[model samples]
Target: MIKSGISQIGGKYRLKNILIDNTPYHEYFLSLFCGSCVYELNKKKANHYECFNDKNPEIANYFIVIKKFFKEFEERRKKGPYTIISRYLYDLLNAGILTPDDMIEQAIQFHYKIKLSFASQLKFRGLIPETTSKKQFITQAKKDFKEAAKNRNRTEGHFKNSLGKTTRPISNNDCGILTPLNPKLEKRLKYVIIEALDFRDLYNRFYRSYYIKKGLTKEVFIYADEPYPGTEKYYGNLFKPEDHQDLIEICLNSPFNIMLSTGGECGIYLDALGDAGWFIKEVYTRYSTNANNQNLTKEYICMNYDIGKVHKMVMDNQPNIMNYVEG
Candidate 1:
């Protein structure tokens, strides 16, 4: 499967199989909030029209550059010396002091900020430990290893020598490997339609342009993975509480088959969707990094149609369009 180099917190990449397995029959698929697009890139698509939309301009531009200007981008990166971007450059980019003259450079800078920044978050909180210079990190690692070895020798029993087990330094030159410049990814995005617009506008535009006007009578599915409530601060763009409420209302009223994912504990969202007759499926997920080792959490998938009926749609080999009605 083709992979997206972009990393996003709370991305649906890990849950791709669970989602694909549960998804109903559809001829057209729309990703309303396609951050990182990890799920889209990894999942299989057969004879289906796919549209990936995100409100962030940087993200939309990144995909566009990959799809169209990839040949020039590859040549430029290969010719230029590999120098790590500094925190000052990051600040300048944010301040608009070092705005690039072209979209390729803009994509380069954007990828750098995401890969080198802490947690791969778009917002610049701080540089990762791996951003440190190679020589300095190696020297520090040696000193720490010696001290840890001495302490391990002094200790006893099952835990003895557990420290300094890793010979590699915490900070290294691994960031270069994470560059979002893969040719495979460029091929994957060759035919994808990317858009940077408000979520509501995207929904309305695609519904009219692709479904209604095109006379597509088959079932159309929209996969919405909006930023979970209370985690809006992590995104460069915001999804306010009112926006969440609006999304619920829109999804509830839309004729398209909808599957929306959000935090399992968000009571406001769960309560609203439940009262609106939406089916909520809870799944357990884990995070291996960060969060003070509190790794396990629940994610809820709210769907407009019963997944049990999904097999019928496939078996009957007929269009099972949803009929939206007012309560």
Candidate 2:
């Protein structure tokens, strides 16, 4: 499971409560960062000091402070950036100052303020890497900051669109299922699942047809395979099973009920959920009979199913069972 917390390094005040309660955009940003932090911390055993050695000590210390801060808020992990923000808003609603209606707009403004403040702090502390004659660290920082601003704007736009509309809270029973709020947006919910190795084209296709067009219903879900590690030279040793877990949680919790998984790789998580009595539905992508093969027919079999349906398929198509992934 992923951990959560609040920072003690930064003082907690009424403003923090108001900011968290009122701002939807900031909530989204913080949730994304929390997911990313979970991926990093779980994947690497090293402390922040060791992992961020390239950064200034003060900058690294700030990250340590952040890590500690979020550690206090670990129990409430929700899906999607919006839902994550909503979780914080819900907490603020308990504090008796802000109404649920005020959250989305407040969260957006707070998110922008946090980003700007953090960036300024980094610059003020000289923690942002100094530019060299050959390498332009300052230029890279500027580009990254611009990108961050752009993404924040996009999130803010989405949050603004949610105002004046009431969103029904999703229940635990609706976990794996998609529920449409608007009938007109239903078509955007159809999704195609592909191996992470085959993700390039599929990602482009999904973004162009669904995400970019803004045609997606709140219910449409994408189930993507996790990418294979070591595909990039710089990231060779950086990938880990936990990183995939973080990615899976992010997708599972998104505005659209999209899901991404490397089916086999996610077995650990699935098994854990199953042990917790969560209902798991197994969908077979392919099949092969060879028992010794890593990707085999039996492995794809549903744990919840008895011998009836699967046995019938196996008996009817013996040849199909031999069509395992090529070694």
- Against the reference, the lDDT scores of all candidates come to 0.73, 0.29
* lDDT tens digits, residue span 1-327, model 2: 222111111111212222222111100011111111222222212111112111122223334333333222122122323233233443353354553233233322233222322211211211233235214544665565555444443454563232223232221322111222222111111120112222333334544655468665332333322332222222233345446555544443344332222244456556544564433444433322121222321111112222223222121223544467442
What TM-score does model 2 achieve against the real structure? 0.21
For each of the candidates, the C-alpha root-mean-square deviation to the true structure, in angstroms, is 9.3, 24.1
Q: What TM-score would each prediction reach against the true structure?
A: 0.75, 0.21
Q: Which segments of model 2 are wrong by more than 4 Å?
A: 1-216, 227-239, 259-261, 271-279, 283-327
Question: In lDDT terms, how accurate is model 2?
Answer: 0.29
At residue 120, candidate 1 shows an lDDT of 65
Best by lDDT: 1
* Residue 81 lDDT (model 1): 32
Quote the positional error of residue 18 for candidate 2 in Å.
47
Error of 2 at 256 (Å): 1.2
Which whole-number lDDT from 0 to 100 does residue 199 have in model 2?
Answer: 30
